[model samples]
Target: MSDRAETSERTTMAPRASELGDFLRARRAALRPEDVGLTPYGERRRVPGLRREELCLLAGVSVTHYTRLEQGRGTRVSREVLTAIARALRLDEDEISHLMDLAAPARRPAQPRPEHAGDSARQLINAMAQVPALILDRRNDVLAWNGLGHALLGGHLDPGDPDLPAHRPNLTRMLFLEEHMRDLYGEHWPEEATLAVASLRLTAGRNPDDRRLAELVGRLAVQSGEFAERWARHPVRTCTSGTKRMDHPVVGRLELAFETLQIPKSPGQRLIAYSAAPGSPSERALRDLLPQGRPDAEERPRAVLSAVASRG
Candidate 1:
């Protein structure tokens, strides 16, 4: 906790740059001449990948214009230009989305008060009795969660982290900072970590006016080198549905599929649910954690008897 004192002192803000430059630079370096159908002819290359001139030529933009873009000098880049560049760079959907995000102009609107989960949202999560469900806000703060969610994901952590805005648990923060949480992904930790950071990048771009989020980024960058490195990658992805490989200490290994449902009425909130296929061993293990028919003798802290979805 004392470590946060260092980051809390500065007024460093987010959108530190459209990150357009960093993303462009990294992507450019990742590509090779042969990969792009360009002949290098063993010219004793001094640069990492394609030169700024080469990429500009391939992207069909003037070298000067593309150089300015890579230097973070362009305040506003045209969509047509971005599209051409994306095509030239062979960017996938996610990478293209990220490129757009990084090139987006900055906004400094008034920061609104921390929004809490509505009564309906709270009730909705509780209603998902057998499934582990959680409500997250724009900043990836855990606003509310069902009992199963608490047992399934947060058994070793404090339940109150979802309640108070000041004490709320940021999903990206925990993925890197907490050991137990990091272990949840087991062998697939790299994918999980990358997706978590990329999804967070998307969220951060959309909520640039949120001061607490800005501070969260600063804090993470200062406290965890892993988070800092991932943040710099400028990865972008919308992780709506995915399969998770989790190893719970009690239930052994569980492979579950998860989905994210956006709340229409809520502008920046989503309900995430995790479940295993019916009749599978994973499903049976998950069911064992729920309390529909489980006896008291078999119940423990991991057994969620009812939805105590109250925020601490």
Candidate 2:
């Protein structure tokens, strides 16, 4: 594709300051005056939440300065100023980190690099034979998945799909665009959908230079109105661990607690493993999903599956 055409399709190609401004505006609009301990004097309010002037006063910044920052004209923002604004906005740690990223995104290579699960990461997931585990990139592209992971989350897909760079199943895409995945979450789909979008929002802010990630957002926004709506809300969060309620086609309903462990030295790459509480029905169902002849519980498997191979 031509450079201009490609750039046009990328959602992150917009100026960083503009994104920062939009995020600030959204967060500012969501907060009411009383929420921040400011008694409303009621001067015929027009805006939803704290006005730019009110926020500037609360943040200890001048109206013109805050206005410049909000209007995408402020290129150089200090950490102190950002911290002050974050406090006034009542932003949590994740949101503060997001603000910092928007103000000063880490420089990345202009080229998009191929993402692959390392040999050790694959070995680690396979070692946890009893657990359902998958390795995903910042964009939530499934780089690799153990057999149980495939069985639990994507039995309908080809087991080797993750090995293909061009065809890697993106979790966020499947959540909104794929029917089988939507069916897996059942009635709790909306909650899962929201969390997925919120998590993606953080990734989008942190990796503004990622063209593929930008294209993913653009495609989802165009194809899924629900995704577009949530994206517009600008939800930002870090879900390192959580419980997922799912209705598996094979195992039925399961309340599985999942943990996301970041791979050392690999930014945005993490291993997500899911398990149920001991003696619970969910645990029993999980056990049933394990591969047959998995060496006795006390013993490790003789070898890992070929599906977990590293890139050549």
Candidate 3:
């Protein structure tokens, strides 16, 4: 089978309602009336979480207005209103950004595609030498990867295919669809997968009109019941740096620190680098494997040109 495999049909579902409403509804359901210091006189509640009236009151908005907003009636909304609701919901910086994105007056425009991983970014990854690095677009599609990255995450697949958009390896997709990726996380698979979904939720909210992104979502939702269930939860989070626990079949267990660096030249692209702490056992293991991967490709550190041009 070819690497970077995709479903043959590549189906897309009918677009759901403005995600603004869905987001509000989901978040609202995740809290309880008492959680926000409200009492219902011990009366049985009809719905989960706080009632719409309760939330509106807490958000300092009228019942009718809040109801309308949740019903997808906003052609435009004030930042003040959004801020108020975000405060009432106790949203974090990442969640607040997602809220604002969902509640924006209108989507600016669809991103035709994200920028390529330029030469500088590729060289940066190469220069890191010991670091396993991969550049990914906003949609979580791998744009470029150094040899260590390819070996660390996807040794069984073709490393070059991700440089080409038509067959790019979407990290989230691989986590769910490819058995190898799921196994790599071992005991941490659930946490890793949840983070991926949550991060994607924030990205989707921010770029609702990106057609390719929407297609990816629809495809994942259709193919993986696990993905569909998680996506419906509407989890949101922003993560720049984190630690990962991975079990490589060849390298054994690895505890690595990862940093996600945004590419300034490519608005929607980010270069993620992974390394174990210096002098640590994980670092030694990484060193042992760094030279083990296939680095036979002549263009080892070449830039990832735009997806259209890079494809075979």
How big is the RMSD of model 1?
5.3
Give per-residue lDDT, candidate 2, residue 225. Answer: 76
TM-score of every model?
Answer: 0.85, 0.89, 0.89
Model 2 ranges with Cα > 4 A deviation: 1-10, 105-109, 292-312
Instruction: Kindly indicate the candidate among 2 and 3 with the higher lDDT.
Output: 2
Which 10 successive residues of model 3 have the least lDDT summed?
2-11
Poorest 10 consecutive residues by lDDT, candidate 1: 297-306
Please provide, for model 2 over 1-312, each residue's C-alpha lDDT reduced to its tens digit, 9 standing for 90 to 100. 644343334444667887898899999999999999899995888888999988988999988988998898987888999999999999999999999999994466368977878778878887898899999999999988887898898878876778777778999999999999889999999999999998998988888888888888888877787887788788999999999999988989999999999998688899999999999999999998986754442222222234334334
Query: In terms of lDDT, which candidate is stronger, 1 or 2?
Result: 2
lDDT (Cα) of model 1: 0.75
| Ranked by lDDT, top first | 2, 3, 1
- Per-residue CA lDDT of candidate 3, range 33-80, in tens? 778888866778888888988888988987888887788775667899
lDDT of each: 0.75, 0.84, 0.79
lDDT of 3 at 293: 44
Per-residue lDDT of 27-142 in model 1, one digit per residue for the tens? Answer: 88878877888887666888788887778878899888888877767777899999988887889888887777667777665667776677688777777888888999877788
